[model samples]
Target: MASNPPAPEAPFVPSQRSTEPFGSGSYRTDEGPWEEWNPTEESLRPVRGRHRVAKQRGGLARSSTVLGVGVIAAVSAGGMASANTGKPPVSISMPDLPSVGSLLSDDSADAAEAPTAPLSGIGVTSADTAQGTTDAGEALRTRIMAQAEQQQDQVDTKAAAASAAAAQKAVADAAAKAEKEAEAKAAAAKKKADEAAAQKAEAARLAELAKQYTLPTSSYTITSTFGQAGSMWSSGYHTGLDFAAPTGTLIKAIHSGTVTEAGWAGSYGYRTILTLDDGTELWFCHQSSISVSVGQKVATGDVIGRVGATGNVTGPHLHLEVHPGGSADGIDPMAWLQGKGLTP
Candidate 1:
């Protein structure tokens, strides 16, 4: 009976999850916040399309940049190798890259239509392969630069040599020209001096001849010349020239001679024959007085006799005759005197 009475009215115990609402004093509302939740991939599908293309473009640009870096590293390595080997670098040609326009284009349809081959298929591959290509390119650049520098040096050397040669040639030419001018001047001066000397010598010779010779008389007129046509002499023609002058007029020796004869002849009165150095004889006939004796030497212009009317003369005159080689026949005295530079 007591146990039946114990279970009576067991205390009003609340359930594990209370169904009653909190009190207003705790600052709660009937519409409380829900539990925190995490979203899944499917639940975020609405925003995927907006950013997908941008992501793809960014990835392409990053890949291209990485390829460029690899190439640069390879080039640096090759340059170092050539410097150590002391050999010329190799040459490399790079393929054309995509332009900015092609890279920035967003037309997927166009990209699909073009359908270019991958980098590996077109002879470019991993980072190692790019490095090797870049190394070859660097070697080529080094070779080109070296060749250019060598060519420039050679050109400069040649220019310098040519300039030096030209200068030397100019100097030589100028020296040669100066020498030739000096020689020509000397020759001209010498020739002029020689000509002046010759002229002076000829003048002196003429003066000497004038001093050594004189006329037979001071003032006389030629009346008859040698070879004149007439019977005035024993021969067929006049054999001596007649110089008409006043009686006692002085007669002189024409040139230096020795008196060979000073005696009278049948047709000559007080005649004198003078023999010269060349065996030529000069005869002075019909003289008033004979001062020079036989075998006497007389100089030119010496008073030998005087003019008078003697044999072979018509009046007070002197007959003169010139014989070459002491011959009988006489030549014209006027012509013979002119041959000795005398204007008789």
Candidate 2:
């Protein structure tokens, strides 16, 4: 028991670590994994040649990204490494962290550290500071006044819009009413014009009737002429034209006139006298019967008496005579008939 079985065989120990950081946490190394010693600069040269540290980022975007992140980190980190000699193998702290204002120029530091001005338009006041709040009180008053004015302006704008709309509606309605009135006036004028035209046409028709008239007893051929030498005339010449016809031949007025006499005359015998508006008188002598009475309104072609062989007529004939006034006077009956549109 004291001999302990001649000391069991010792377990094998692994070789010591090399000097490379990947192998033994050191930067200088030349041996394989089994080497247990550090290396000098000459011995580590080959390992240094075998690997490389990249000089710059690959693309511009990558470079920019790296540069931006590095710059931001360095500015904010506020500490620098004190030694690069690889002694102690750890980073050492620098004493001073430069303030952003001290590290940059006055312009850059002001741009970076300056508090932004407040947004302007509605709440701005004349003063820029607010230590005692005197300016702040005035600014608050101004803002409240501006807000009230804005509310009043909104109400005024709505009222103006309503008024304008009402005015436009009224104008449109007035235009429509005026158009309707114009149409009605045009229609009325057209109707009145049509009536005037009809009245004119009727007057023209009556005038045409008066233009074409003659004594009905005339056969257009005078059997005896007035002023011709004849025994039947009381003034030594024929006092009237003799138009021979049947005893009951119809008689007609020479023109538009009024009957002045329709009774027996001393010499004319069953006579009717017509007086024209121009004061000219016409006598129908030796009428078998009178068809129109005295004072009767007679137009052209109206019957006044009949043809008969009475008075001084020797046979069935009409004794027609003219009287300038009412006295028995003689005139050419043919010429007088032509004046009344009677064509012989």
Which candidate should be chosen as best, given lDDT against the real structure? 1
Query: What TM-score would every model get versus the actual structure?
Result: 0.41, 0.38
lDDT of 1 by residue, 1-344 (tens): 45444456543343333243443445344422222223344544342211111123335577477557756765665565454432333433333434222333465643554332333333233764677778889999999999999999999999999999999999999999999999999999999999999878867876787788877886778788878888767787888778888999999998898999997876788899989999999999898888989999999989988887777667898888999999877899878876665765
Cα lDDT for residue 206, candidate 2: 48
**Which residue pairs in model 2 clash with each other?**
none
lDDT of 2: 0.65
The alpha-carbon root-mean-square deviation between model 2 and the true structure, to one decimal in Å, is 21.2
Report every candidate's CA lDDT: 0.72, 0.65
Name model 1 segments beyond 4 Å from true.
1-204
In candidate 1, the residue pairs with backbone N, CA or C atoms under 3 Å apart (3 or more residues apart, or in different chains) clash, namely none
